[model samples]
Target: MSTTFEEITRPDNGPLVELNNNMQEVFSQYRKMREYASYLEYELKQKDEHILKVENENSFLRDKHTTFDSNGKSVEPIIT
Candidate 1:
C-alpha cells in the first residue's frame, strides 16, 4: 500500500506537523535578523571611519591656519 500526505499528516499527527512548521519559521526569521545585524555593523564601521577621517582633516586645517602674536601667544580668530 502507498502512503499519501493526507494519511501521514492526519489529525493524530497534526501537533507534530504544526510544531515542525513553527520551528522552521523561527529559524528562518533568526537567519534574516542575523544578516541584518551584520549589515548594520558594517555600516556603523564605515561611518566611524569616515568620522575619523573628517576629524583628522579638520585638525590638520586648524593647525595649518593657526596664528601667533609677537608676544608668543596664540591669537584667536575674530568672528565679527
Candidate 2:
C-alpha cells in the first residue's frame, strides 16, 4: 500500500499540519527583510565619506585664492 505525504507527516490530526506550514512561511519572510536592512546601512556609509572629501577640497581652494591681493599686497585673514 502507498501512503500520502500528509498521512505520513501528520497522521495524528489535521490542525497540527496546518500550523506547521504557517510557521515555515513566517520565518522565510523575516529572513528576506533582514537582508534588505543590511544593504541600506552599507549605502549610507558610502555617501557620508563622499561628502567629507568634497568639503575638504573646497576649504583648500578658498585659502589659496585669498592669500594675496591683485597689487601683490598681503590680504588680511577673514574670520569664520
Candidate 3:
C-alpha cells in the first residue's frame, strides 16, 4: 500500500502533530487577546464620550447657574 501526500499531511496523522497542537494553542491565545483588546478599546471610547458629554453638560449648567436671566449678566465674580 502507498500513502498519498494528502493522507500524510492530514491533521490526524501528521508527523508534526505536537507542533501543530502548540501552534493551534498559540493561535487561540492570540485570538483571545485580540478580542480582549478590541473590547477594551470599545470600553475606553465609550468612557471618553461619556466624559466629554458630562463635561459639556456641566459647563452648560454652570453657565446657566451663574448668568442672571433678567439682564443677561453674570452674577458670579469673574476670576482673572
Candidate 4:
C-alpha cells in the first residue's frame, strides 16, 4: 500500500499592510521635526545678533560716563 501526502500553503494576513502605513506616518513626523529644528536655529541666530548689539551699546555708554565735566570734575557713578 502507498500513502500520498498533501502540501499546505499559508494565507497572508493584512497586518503587514498596516505596518507599512504606520512607517510612512513615522517618516512624515520625522520631517516635521527637522523643519522645527531649522526654525529654532534661525531664531537663535537673531537673538545672538541682538545681544551683541546691546553689549556694544553698553560699552559705549560706559566709556562716555568716564569723561569729566566741562569744569574738569568727576561725574556720578552709573550702574552697569
Candidate 5:
C-alpha cells in the first residue's frame, strides 16, 4: 500500500497529522535500509559460491599435476 503526500497531510487527522508524518519518515528509512541489507546478502551469497567453485577447480588441477612420493612429500609432475 502507498500513500500520496496529500493523503498523508489530510485535515481529518487534525492534531495527529504531524506525528503521523514523522512516523512515516522513519518507516520510509527503515524500508530503504532493509532493501539495502537484502541486496548485500544476495551479493555475499554469490561471492561465496564463486569462491567455492574456484577452490574446487584449483584442488582438482593441483591433484592432477602432483604425485605423492614414498617419503610422504608432494612431488610435482614434470611435463617434458
Candidate 6:
C-alpha cells in the first residue's frame, strides 16, 4: 500500500535523463568552437592573400627603382 506501482516496478530513469542532457550541452559547446575555428581560418586566409599582394607590389616597385651595372651587379637605388 505504501509503495507506488512506479517505484516498485519501473527502473529509475532520472540518471539517464541527466546523462542525455549533459551530452546535449557538450555537443552545443562543440558546435560553437567549430564555428569559431572556421571564422579564424577565414581570417587567416585573407591575411595571407593580403601579404602576397603586398609582396608582389614591393617586388615590382623594387625592380622599377633599382639600377643594374654592366658587370651584372646592382647599384645604389635612386628613389625619386
CA lDDT, every prediction?
Answer: 0.91, 0.82, 0.87, 0.90, 0.91, 0.94
Q: Which candidate number has the best lDDT?
A: 6
Query: What local lDDT does model 3 show for residue 52?
Result: 100
Candidate 3 Cα RMSD after full superposition onto the native fold (Å): 7.5
Given candidate 4, what's the lDDT at residue 50? 100
Per-residue error (Å), model 6, residue 59: 0.6
lDDT of 2 at 10: 33
Q: Which tens-of-lDDT digit does each residue in 1-80 have in candidate 4? A: 99898997776767888899999999999999999999999999999999999999999987877767889787786679
Task: Name model 5 segments beyond 4 Å from true.
Answer: 1-15
The digit string of per-residue lDDT tens for model 2 on 1-80 reads 99666544636766888898988888888888888888888888888888888888898877776778799786987889
Residue 72, model 6: lDDT of 75
RMSD of 6: 4.8
Query: Would you estimate the TM-scores of all the predictions?
Result: 0.71, 0.56, 0.67, 0.62, 0.74, 0.79
Error of 4 at 24 (Å): 1.0
What residue pairs clash in candidate 5, if any at all?
A: none
Clash count list over all predictions:
0, 0, 0, 0, 0, 0
TM-score of 4: 0.62
Q: TM-score of predicted model 6?
A: 0.79
In candidate 6, which residue ranges exceed 4 Å CA deviation?
A: 1-8, 78-80
Better of 4 and 6 by TM-score: 6
lDDT of 6 by residue, 4-34 (tens): 5554577899999999999999999999999
Among all candidates shown, the one with the greatest TM-score: 6
The Cα error of candidate 5 at residue 76, in Å, is: 2.7
